[model samples]
Target: MSRFLYLDNAATTKTAPEVLEAMLPYFTEKFGNPSSVYQFAAENKTVVDEMRKIIAESLGAKSKEIYFTAGGSEADNWALKATAEAYQAKGRHIITTKIEHHAILHTAEYLERQGYEVTYLDVDEDGKVDLEELKAAIRPDTILISVMYANNEIGTVEPIREIGEIAHEHGILFHTDAVQAYGHLPINVDECYIDMLSASGHKLNGPKGIGFLYIRTGVKIRSFIHGGAQERKRRAGTENVPGIVGMGAAVKRAFDTMEERTAREKEVRDYLIRRVENEIPYCRLNGHRTDRLPNNANFSFQFIEGESLLIRLDMKGICASSGSACTSGSLDPSHVLLAIGLPHEIAHGSLRLTINEEISKEDVDYVVDSLKEIVEGLRNMSPLYEDFVKKQEKNV
Candidate 1:
């Protein structure tokens, strides 16, 4: 078997060496609770504060606006629940898109069960929200609007700035789950009209288990984590000092070489797309060609089960997936693809191939070649394909 080509970066990334190096000291010699009063505690406190400033700068936000959390899920839960509690009197309603990550979608559903009205707007075939539907969904009682910055499965970038503006026009707070978009593209809170934003560290080569929520100045949100005074009381408890430190370092490196990294991923990503299309038969590329993450490449092949293909690819030392990791357990088709109007059968057969900076042209070629072989072999075994071939022969 060939060296495992890791093309599933959307799931999680391997921590960068620089990030690991930066986080080392916090685990042992520098270990101290940021909340302690002693010099040792003050040292960790100061370091985490500096990490905040660096991460804030990357998002074009002030250090005061950054609130650390367990991960993207916590940030998202906080953004939704806190915003709802803070403004429930103004409106008990919230608006969001249908293709969002389960973090936001499930949270919104939970809010619905708690008596909040949630309006789930549908996306177009291109995985874009209907601005007109958005215009219609905003009621006088609508208190918040949360949209993910990108679709995790198919890599569709949303019109978040416009959605944010629409929410603001109605005096409603706006939030975006930028876990997938934070390091992949440029983000500015003011320019995008975002009032609350959530991001995860691991998506950008930082260690997992740490993330941040950005609350715009003057935006009121109730605290989700009720505990000791920390994160200026917006978030509570001692921070993950090492993980936060690694996030800052990873963020800095990503920005320093962002353009170069994006360009390289784009080149290789496109090469893989073209190679698969030319080499494989009956393949349908999912998601927009240009308005997607530079590293994402999703496709569906007829008469081939995505899960079966995944296993075969894994055996061949090429790692990819049948869509978002969160949605893999159930046999249900991916919600993102379904929201984009794919039939359930086609959606079930979808594969997402995400490339990272470490992936090379050779890796892409290997996956494409392996995919062609797998799809062909699977189709040969598929009863549906055999029936189709038999019917075609009779017609001829």
Candidate 2:
């Protein structure tokens, strides 16, 4: 393709040049195992410690609270499973929302199989968890409340502070999967009363397969992996020195430019949303319009299949998504859309476009222009659209 435009930042981001530069030395000349007693090797351990401090400071957490993991999924799994196991004596009930990432949902399901009672709370039409409903869901046996900071598919930012308040009032632990919000949104673990939070480097322009979980001191969670004394004897493995360096660089860069970069992304994102809403027919915007991630814009066209729309967009050299990258291979409609009360047919027609600092107004224009023509063409060929048109003609 002569021209390519990427609008799927939520799925993954391009690694920054600075981040790569920071990581290269670890793979070649500085290839030293952190656990080794030699000074050269143990110096690499200092690099890991420096990165932990960087990540911890960004979240207003102490350095010791951060534990590195392979990625967000592992961090999430560790948070849920270990917390459940650690606190089972106190309670076996957990609370989460219906629109969580599959990492959380599937883990919760597994917990259910193991004799834990999980209550999947519902959301409104805009994919916002109802605080009243959350309050009502709590019981004496509820040990934990896990919620995502934002919906990856729909872009709805949940009321995390409010949820945390509720959880704390009831003496329950609060864990948030902040994979989509860690760099994109400003978060303070202390200010939000967050007991545990998960974040992945790949979501913020770092290398893949590195993430961290921040556990409040004295939480008493068990070790997720058992072998060596890595990650403060909580998670066991050889330290990923290069990935840690890359993530530290990425996090620093993101935090340094967050205000300016997010402002630009939000402008482009809103422009795209307005153009699509004005030009596209029989479509609805998904998620809370104002209380959403700065770069996410999702829509559901009435009569077009999302996968077909995705294929056509790809042909035009545009990179977008129907939903979460994790579940793209599945033919099932998005659970987030269903949680928002959309019918199965409408949910099947969804599209998600997440922009980044690199996206421009002209790029959004090209995408919208391409979408207008593609949606019209797809609708013309759809039997469902044809039936509706015929019915309308008869009424006319």
Candidate 3:
């Protein structure tokens, strides 16, 4: 193909035109610090507050509960660190799953260094956390439970509502890193009993470097950032007026067209999954077949490295990922793939192709065909494939 076919929406999305339009005025005519008491800045402050309300409403939260941050990582860090510090008097234990994005996992690790106990719960083969195991892991002093709404790499949706109920029943706080699931999925914080939730704008066609943390009213958490009294003194720093405005526009558009977009994306996703598996030998689909995100299709092709496959796909003007964009340069196999019990070799060969509204049936077909050819060509040069073929022939 002459033009690029982007299939890595899971990592980030192209900023929507509407979102860009909404932000343009803020960068030019409306550029004013929201913290300033002057009349000129009042408009920017109003825009920030309005955007916060819109985001809060989308999550079924109060405007006061919404606090804007740099992005999902900052929100995740604040959620884990601030909550742990504030509630340490009550307890010091936290529960999280093994397959969370590094934002949550690494923050949990930081808490452990500070003498807090964290139980990293294991997931099943499909990357779904076991509710029974979660219940068993909760201790008398457990004060918080952090889990992602969905797996970023494998695209497995976790049982967030159930986990939230369990946390509330035990008088513990529940926080979910909804970076991958927020705009793509339907989320109502009240119904799920979530005390805290994190979302990034870039994941949903909004501007980068903007996101929010939803803290349910009455949740005791300290401020992570200390500076000017912004975000109602919960988060400090002059707000990114343009980014916030862009995020609000993006969130509105995403929710407005969510139903139709999800349906269409799922059709393309399923078609891609079926074609790739049917045409490619020794390729296995990762994550839950039906319960995963509507736009996600992850696979593992044997006897080849994921990086090489990704490079070949890139050569064909196809943009895909081996795993999370954050860990793209790492030599280690995906922690998420290993968490789901994939061996080192299989995990190394994993490929993640995430679709968006722009992806079409033709694009899916092209990708699958290109992938089949690439995998076959790479495997033909592999000693592993030759050995497996020889063993099979001898057995026959």
Candidate 4:
């Protein structure tokens, strides 16, 4: 308990020992460019292809359909921009939720500047997009609909299959930013009718600089990167052999242990949720109760700034988040929390705890205890809490 207890797995995971072992050989002994024609590099090329096969099988995709990228942001950017450019002749309209990661949101905005029309769908109080509203938003010129499989901030699992069905019914291509959901959840591209999916290796306990985009067979997307032929000319760059091997190892282990891991994490997550709600007054859970990620538990404590709470938690040897790590430096309130109907002040106080397979019930208990002390201590000094207490008493 004296050591750092990391509860920020949603931002990035600690690379597993097995994954590091799998990558070490590639970094030293097997280091070679897959694009090289020499036999020395051919072995690395074979290893790369094997890694691709492992990731493809994990997503129920074919090896040729998987394209590796620098990380999730690159994959998401590629999915939106490349698909928009390639399909502009078919339509110039794209649709996505307001609560997507900045990669998607910024890309959508850029596409809008490029003369494409975009529909930013609104989510309900539980952070779920309405399928009916989505259906109503579609137009004859709609080319694509992009949504996250799981939210990074609040951990709400969107109804991807339903969204996919709605998109396909209208002949529009569907893309999902599955960076948060990829290794944690069981996703079969065909079963879900997903045309494109983005994922990052770091989110799944693999190396940070590597990720992949699963582009369904026959889906046309223009090249996002331009250079020597790589990724079958879909993506162009020297492959990250070590990172790819590590990702394959991580993904394989995830698949092998997913069911057990998910069950355990869910049990601990629910228990933490229950304990926090019972122990802490004037705190609200941010995401849906049941239809949320097994690893994520987000809450907004009244009358406290999230940054201050995070600092106190860090002092207690617990590493949590106010919101997405990508936006942790920003002073603005969490857009995800705001989209889910939280007021600006409540959103500013949000805390996100994302559990990993390594976390235990004992760890959750310690976190809850630490949180109780921190919230109470912070509230004792807050004039807003005093005002809130007086207002409640007056109402009573």
Candidate 5:
């Protein structure tokens, strides 16, 4: 396409140039198995440890706490499943919100089938988990609480520190899927009382197929994969050296630019939200107004289908998402929207735009302008909209 505007950074981001540059040497000249005995390979192992230290420092954690995994999904699985097995003697119940990513939700389901109990907590309309409800959900058998740091669809930032405190108060382990909030927000594991966290490289402009699970020192969790003594025997398979280097570089770059980048993103994001609310008729903005990610703007246009709106935006060279990219292909409405008390029809009309620092006010204006036209055209063809308009005219 001659013109392209990518507003789907939540799905994935283009690897930053600096990250790619750092990774290039590893793929060619420095290619060596970190698990080998030779000096070349031993040096690679040192680099791996250094990358781990970088990731740890970002989270205020120790290098030994970070375990490399294939991606966020794997990390999430390892955190939940392994925690369950390790603590099964102590408890068999787990707690999580209804709006978590499928990686966590599906894993919870698997745990249920395996004879474990799970409590799916409710959230407010703004997608904030009810702290009181959380307190009530904690039983003696509740071993773990897994909540996402920030939502991928609506961009609602959860009360992570508070949740972590609650989990600790109950003497239970807490884990957060920080795939969306890692590079975008500031986090410190000790201050938050967080036992474990999962984050992905691709979400922060690093290479894909790489992620890390940070287990607090002395969590006593077993390995997810069984094989060679990679990741301190916590995870199997050879380390992705280039990916690790790229992730380290990306994390540092993200933090270095975060203050300025998110400040500008918030300014533009609020502008986009304001324009959409003022200009688009019958469209409702999702998520909290100010307590959300800097770049997330989600809206639900009444009497229009989300899929059709996405196609129209795509045709206009603007990319967005209906919900989470993982479930965009599915016809079902987002569980996140439903959990927040949205009706099925309204949820079906939802659109999520996660912009980057590069998106300007002008770009947002263009997107909002395009949205007005697309929503109007789609509503014209929708029988639901036709019926509603006829009733409105009769009342007038």
Candidate 6:
């Protein structure tokens, strides 16, 4: 078997060593409840506060603004449901993109059953929400707009600032699922006029099951969880002390090295794009050329199933993904690809390779070379391609 090449960083990244080091003590030496009033607990409490402070500072927010949760899904859930329930008096109408992660989309659906109205804004061919559609969606009843900062499958970044302005102009709250964009891209809640932002730690080389939601100072939201006095009584349950510590360390390390990391990742991403286009036949990139995530490279083969391509790459010890593994079991093409105006066949043939900050040129070259072969083999078996060829030949 060949050595594995992990390129699925978007799904999750290996926890950084520095982050692990920071979290170690919390699990053993300093394992005390942050709420405990004893001297022993005071030590851990101080650490949690520092973690909150640094994370908040990195996002240009106040320490109290950052509330930890169990990864992006929970944060997204809390942001939408909490705000909807609290602001139901104002209106039951909400706006979000059709391509939002299930965390937000499903929650919005659940809200509909509970008598809330939701307007799902459509995106353009590049997977960007149409600002005009968003503007038109707003009404006197509009209460909130929850658009993602960047797409998970296609990697297209949204016009969050514009969306925020639109929401505010209509007297509505704006939330962004920044799970994929927070650490990789600089995000200031104030700059984007963001009322709420969700970020996951594992996406930035921190411990899994730890995430934070940035709630603007005056944003009105009710608690979904109950029982504890934790999270300023906003969220309940015991604090994930070690996970919180690790997340802070990871956030600090990420932004500290952001520029260098961004440049390298972008270079590799563009190189992969160039190589696949320059080397493979009938390949088309799935997202915006320059308006996508720095580490995301998604493409569609002319006539191949994404699942089959994923397995081929996997057998070669190349860890890539077709779409979000969270939605892999579903035979339906990614809603993102479909929303971007891609034909069903094209959407089904998509491949996503999200790279690490450290993947070298050679690794990408190998993957590109392997892809060229795999796609050719897959295309050979494709009756559609064969028919296309025959039709072209007859026309000639």
- Per-residue CA lDDT of model 3 for 274-368, tens digit only, reads 89888888989999988899999999999999999999999999999999999999999999999999999999999999999889999887888
> TM-scores of all models?
0.98, 0.99, 0.99, 0.98, 0.99, 0.99
RMSD of 3: 0.8
Model 3 TM-score, all chains together? 0.99
> Could you report the Cα RMSD, in angstroms, for every candidate shown?
1.1, 0.7, 0.8, 1.0, 0.8, 0.9
Off by over 4 Å in 2: none
lDDT of 4 by residue, 7-58 (tens): 9999999999999999999878899898999999999999889999999999
Estimate, for each residue in 341-390, the C-alpha lDDT of model 2 and write its tens digit. 99999999999999999899999999999999999999999999999999
- The Cα local distance difference test for each model comes to 0.90, 0.96, 0.93, 0.93, 0.95, 0.91
Top-lDDT structure, candidate number: 2
Which lDDT tens digits does candidate 6 get at residues 1-396?
576899999999999999999999988988999999999998888889999999999989999999999999999999989998899988999999889999999999999999999999889888988899888888898888999999999899998888888777777899999999978998888888899999999999999999999999988897878989899999898899999999999999999999999999999999999999899978889888899999999998877899999998898889988788689799999898888888999888999999988899999988988988889999899999999889989999
Q: What does candidate 1's lDDT look like per residue over 1-396, in tens digits? A: 757788889999999999999999999999999999999899999999999999899888999999999889999999998888889889899999889899999999999999999999998888888899999988999988899998888888888889888888888889999999989899999888999999999999999999999999999887899998998987888889999999999889888989999999999999999998888877888888788999999998888788999999999998898898887798988888888888887887899999998889988877887888888899999998999899989999
Enumerate residue pairs that collide in model 6: none
Tell me the deviation in Å of residue 373 in model 3: 0.6
lDDT of 6 at 55: 96
Off by over 4 Å in 1: 394-396
True-structure lDDT of candidate 6: 0.91
User: What's model 1's TM-score?
Assistant: 0.98
* Model 1: residue 323 alpha-carbon error in angstroms: 1.1
Superior by lDDT: candidate 1 or candidate 5: 5
Question: Positional deviation of 268 in candidate 4, in angstroms?
Answer: 0.7
Q: How displaced is residue 295 in candidate 6, in Å?
A: 0.2
Q: In terms of TM-score, which candidate is stronger, 2 or 4? A: 2
> Which candidate model has the greater TM-score, 1 or 5?
5
